[model samples]
Every structure is written in C-alpha cells, then in structure tokens.
Target: MNNQIDTLCTESWSCFKAYDIRGRVGEELNEQKAYAIARAYAEVVKPKQVVVGADIRLSSKAMKAAVCRGLVDHGVDVIDLGMSGTEEVYFAVQHWQLDGGIEITASHNPADYNGMKLVGRDARPIGENNGLSDIHKVAVQGHFDNCLPQGEKLTKGCLSEYVSYLVSFINPDNIKPLTIVTNAGNGAAGHAIDAIESQLASLGVPITFIKIHHEADGHFPNGVPNPMLPENRAATTQAVIEHQADFGLAWDGDFDRCFFFDEKGQFIEGYYIVGLLAEAFALRQQGAKVIHDPRLYWNTTDILASSGGQPILAKAGHTYIKQMMREHDAVYGGEMSAHHYFRDFAYCDSGMIPWLLVAELLCVKSMSLSEAVEKRILAYPSSGEINSHIAEPHKVLSKVKAHYSRDAVSIDESDGISIEFEKWRFNLRPSNTEPLVRLNVESRGCQSLMEEKTTELLSFLDR
Candidate 1:
C-alpha cells in the first residue's frame, strides 16, 4: 500500500475527525503517517508507557505495530494489547496504570479506512482543542528528537480483565434463558464475545446465541461492520427474523458503540438504551446523576428523574460528555450517537457495558426489550436524526437560529441550538467530522405537533 507519510496533508485535515482521527487508509493514513503521529503523540503526552490495540482489519495490526515502533523510538515503553477493541484498550490503560493509550481502528468507517483514538492517563479523549493540536503540529513536521537509541516492548492482554469486570456488573448466574442473535460484523469483538459467552454458559444461562459473521475477516466482504447502515445490518436483522430470537445485537469495528435490532426487524435508537441503562444504574446507585446530551429524546431525563437521579445535559461529543461525567460525578452518561460513559469504569465509555446491561435486564425482569421501552417511546416521539449538506454551513445555521434563537422560548448553544417549547423542541448543529448538519426534533408526547414542526422546519430548509 502507498504510505501517505512524509507528505503534506492538504485535505483540510478533515480526516482528523470529531472525536478521533479516521480516513481513507492509503490517501489519508499509512505507516509513515502513523509513525509521525505516534512520535508526535509521544512528544506531547510524554507518557512513560502507552497501551496499544487494534481491530481485525488487515492493515490495523501493521498500523498499530508502526505506532508502537514510533513510540519505542521516542524512548516510550510500549504495552501491546493484542487484538482488542478501543474500549478494552482504554480499560487496559487504566488497569495497568499506564500513562495513556492508543486504539488503532477506524470505528465504523469502511474497510479501506483506518485511524486512531488517543487517550490521556484517565482514559480521556484527546480532541482537537485538547492535545490534538500539538500532536498535529508534530505529525506535520514528521521529525522528532524523542527517538530513543533503544526501548523495551511489553506484550499483555486485557481480555480476561475486561471480561471479568463486565461480568461483575451483572450476575451471569441470574441470567434468564433467552434466544439471542449477536452480529460482530467481522471486527475485533469476536474474542471478547467468546470469553464472555463462555462465562455465561458456565453460569448455566440459556442464551442461545445465533452468531453472525463472528470471524475476524478484515476484507469485510459484507460491507463495513457498522450496523448504523441498513444494508450492513441486514444479516443481523435476518438472523433475528429467521431464528425468531428475543433480540439482535451489533457492534462497530472496535465495539465501543453498540447498535440493536428488535425482534420485529426494527432498528432501535441508542437514546432509548441510555434510558434503560439509567434505570439499571439508578437501581444500583440511588439518586446518582445521569448525564445525557440534548438529542432525539428526553427519555434519559424522564428516566433519571423518575428514578430520582438528576439529569444534566452536555454537548454531544465524547470529550464533552466525559468531562461532564467527571464534573457531576454522574453514575452514567449517554449520547444519541451510541457513546455511553460510566463513572464506575473510571469515566470511560464501554461498548461491552450496554450488552451486559441488556443481559442483566433480561435476567432480572420478565420484560422484552421492546416491552420495556414502550412508555418512553410514547412520551418523546422524535424525528430520529437527520443529516443535510449545505455549501454555506454558518449561514444556514444562523438562518435556522435567527428564526428561533430570539423567540420567547429558552435557547441553548451548548452543543447546538435547541429552541425549547412546551410541546416541541428541535436541535440543529453542524457535525464536527462530516460536511453535513445534524437536525433532531422531538415533541412533548405530541405526535401531530412533532410532524407539523418537523414539516415546518424541513420546509424552511427546503426554502
């Protein structure tokens, strides 16, 4: 493959996306580029040791190795966690008491793409405003003096610890007998699922798993493993349909964020899952606050409040949400985009947590996933999430805001613009990574008004 290193990145650095870096592999990222990034990262963080992991992508393993080489050259010790997800690597960083960590995966991007997500000592995000700017400058230079004459390499695996902690959160002993379909999408989550399922089986839980595409096929012949796409999720949905399973589960490339498909072949939003988790956490830590972003639904707010946990809203990004969880000492936090952070796990988000919680919810209660979500679905009907491209982003946002920002209702620009009304509210914000704007509308349990307001807003955009 052509290495894009030792070259000027003139593509507006859009590849350095919102929360982490991702792009087309050859054109945007390659070994040379990864080396510079790793060297730059070593210089900026100056961490004594860095933990590394990657997905099942063919290039991901090499990309991670190159990064380790760069770090070791920079006189930084490397702790290699072979074949793991992003969150599992993050947990290793915390569990190992290392300085920071790097996860070599492109998240849900296509097979041709790959990237990295960096974290500080506490398993925090290194966003653009944070240390990313310094790292970018170092990467641009592609030369570093921190390269040591020689360094040491340590190989360790966090799979067992990660699985132990996840099982600790829920009792596999109490798990109910249920037929479930889990789709790993040929990513790095197979090993993890294997270990966890073994534990479940040992506990005598009758979880009949109809596993789909569980192998680590880097070719991704079945398209990107991102269940967010209707096409990519077809296999999981089909499994649920054919097997008549209780529900379907899906995870991204690194398994940090999970997606679900109900038995009826319907994709469920991450927002509702947040509410369900809030319920679980509340039961454990009564009156503990839950953090949520202002997107799609207020189900989180309602769930936390009814459960006696305070609900605080933050901007919709991993960095912002993580900071909020720390500030408020929240028991849990979630965004509509499927990122869920937990204070119990050192204020880091885990893709494994949601599935474990789902299993526990099933084991403890007699309710199906759909049955549990019925009341909240009726309370806050949303327009899901809509994305639109605009040549003039600022102008369009201002136009939308001008129409509502000055109204009698309260307005917020925390993450985006949320013009609140008694019966309906809408949030419009530009995405940090994509060239499109994100729009969400929800009503106070009013279906007609939601349709009317959504139509009106789209009409405005149409004009």
Candidate 2:
C-alpha cells in the first residue's frame, strides 16, 4: 500500500487549499489522491471513528469510496452517510460524537471539480493552519502503520433527526401561512428541503413550497447552484416573482451556504441578512454576542448596537469565523457570502438554518424581506463586493493603503486593508487563491458616496 501510494503520487498534490481540499477532478484530485488524503487524515487526526458523506457530483461517490477504503485499511471505523450535504457530515459528527468527518464535495465549483471538507470532534474545522497542512504532508510522504487491525464500516442516517434539529431553531407553531419559492439548482439541497418540508407538514406548519431545479443531477442541467453569481440568480428570482411568493431561498452544491431573494424577486445582499440574523439573536437573548466578517459592517455593527448585541469582527473564511465564535462564545456568526453559523449547531454553518430563521422572523415581524432590510440598506448604503484581477495583489493593496492611509480615521490590516472615515469606510482584501482583490465600500446614508468610492478604488486598482 505504501509503495502504491509512492508510485501513484509522484508529484505534489494541488488539491489542498487554504480552507479545504478542492481542485479539478482528473488533473488534480482523483481516487488515488482521495485514498492518500484519507490515509493522511487517519495518520494525522488519528481518529478512531469517522463519518463520511458525498455530494451529488459524479466523481464524489468514487472519491468517497476510495476515502472509506483508506480509512478502513488504516483500522479506523467508518460511518457511511451516503449522498449528503457538507453540513450533514458536520451534523453527524457532532450529533453522534464521532471522532471526525469528511464530505466529498467541491461546493459550487464547476462540474469538473471535486473536493472535501473535513472536521474533527465537535465539528471543528480542520484547515491549513490547524491540521490540514500536516495531513497534506503525511499524504505526500506516504508513510503509514502496517500493524494495526483493519476496522469496520457502517451505514447510518440522521435525516429525520437533522430535520427536527433544524426546526428546533424556530417555533414551528409561530410560522404563519406563507408561500415560498425554493430553487435547489440541481444540487444536494433538494433532498434536505424535501425532508424539512415533510417535517414542517407533519408539525402542521402552513408553508407552501414552490420548488424549481429541485432534483439532484450531477450534470447540473440547470447550471451549478452558485446563487452568488449574477447569472445564476435569475431563476430563483423569477420563481419568487412568478409564484407571487412571500420570499425565496437558494443553496449551493453542498448546501452549506443559503441565499435569499425577496418577494419582489430582488436578491437581498448577504450583508443585510447578517444584520437581520444578528437582530434576531439579540431579540431572543439580550446582549447576545455575534461574529461578523470585516468586509462591509457598518449596518451589522449599528444593528448590534441598537439591539444590545456585542459584535465581534473576524477575518473572512469559515475556520477563522468558527474560531472567533468559540473564543467569544458568540450566539451566532455570519459572513456576507451567505454562510450563517450558530452556537447550537456546534458552531457550524448551515444553509438550512438561515432561511428557517428568516421565515420565522417574517411571520413574527409581519414584514416582507425587502421591508425588513430596506431601512438598513438606506442607512448604510454599500457597494457589494467587487473583484478586480491583478498581477500583483500586494502591490495593489499597498498602493490603496498609501493613497488612503494618511487621511483615514483608522487603518486595519487584520485581514486586508480596511480604511475608515467618519462617514464612509472600505475594505480591500486580496484573494487567497487567485490573483484578485475584492473591494467593499459603505457610507453612512450615502449611496452615491459608496458608489463613487467603489469606482475610484476599481480605477486605482486597474492602474
């Protein structure tokens, strides 16, 4: 087995990323790589038992089987959670108190790509800084124990319990009669939605679902389920408008992040959703702590202040957000990228939880999604994140800072350059994986100022 790994893996693996493993299937990530990664995880994490699941991608099952084989060969017991979302693996790990878990998914990447998300006990993320680097090293070295007894595998499920757990976030009885449009985009979200819908029906919650692109197809006939893209959002928006629904929801390939659209088919910015969820948490528990990314946060901070919640800022990405949440014991954490994390769910993000809470908030507040966020949008108008490609990202960041730093009220580089003024602020962050810089600008009650600043930053970056 060791010789097989050494012969098969002659080159350094390219699938390892800053947060998780992801790459093109055949060229970068294959069954052999998956097997090596699994063995590496067994060696590094040393978990006695692990839970594994795969998304609907065509390569996922084979990747998952290779992973399982490696784990079993390492004498690590495996719990199989056949075709499921990334969050399901998270749920299974924490709910069952397993040692670790992995989900075979590329998560909104193109059809030709596939990868994995890994977590340890309590569903703690295993990213590059923590354990992923070590795992990568071990996989490349191809060293393993040859004396341990082979372990066994078991097939189990938690769909019903997972549905119940999702429902427990909100009082189902409080849900008012409403029509909702849900677009799964041929991802793994459809099954979970169906299960949740059935559970809500059994609980007598009167919510009608108008589902579109709700089948699991690895070919992605409707396109990849990335609602974050402008082109991918039209179908979900049109569904809401055509159905005359109260609101709409959408999820990515692995269903870890959820996106929302208002009744008027206008897609809500994820920043506003963060504010809404922060307010909801604050209302539920006075002085609740909330974690937010450091991109565009005037509205989030303002809402937290008025709602009596403490807002903690963290660098963007799941691993950093989860660490900050654990550090502060925050009740909830949100990223403007539609990732919502909760304390109750082992500090893990869930595509299912965010929409459920938004639905309940709608019923309780008796306001449309647009109405709920309109005032905040007006008060703290923002330029949604805009990405610009650059050959040298560091030079661009330095130029932006050098230009703005002297007159800036304050400058922060915890994540990237965040320059603040009395009335407006902007964050220019370089991408971890690509030659791009993402800029987000916001101004106090000044949409025009935000737009002007956004344009100015882009123009400067282009130079």
The number of the candidate with the highest TM-score is: 2
Q: Report lDDT (CA) for all predictions.
A: 0.82, 0.92
Q: What's the distance in Å from true for residue 224, model 2?
A: 1.1
Q: In candidate 2, how many Å is residue 406 off?
A: 2.2
After TM-score superposition, the amount by which residue 227's alpha carbon in candidate 1 deviates from its true location, in angstroms, is 1.8
lDDT of 2 by residue, 212-266 (tens): 9999999999898888788999998888989999999999999999888999998
Query: Model 1: which ten-residue window has the lowest total lDDT?
Result: 1-10
Q: What is the lDDT of residue 274 in candidate 1?
A: 85
lDDT of 1 at 184: 88
Top model by lDDT, which number? 2
Kindly give the stretch of ten consecutive residues in candidate 2 with the minimal lDDT sum. 430-439
Q: List the residue pairs that clash in candidate 2.
A: none
lDDT of 1: 0.82
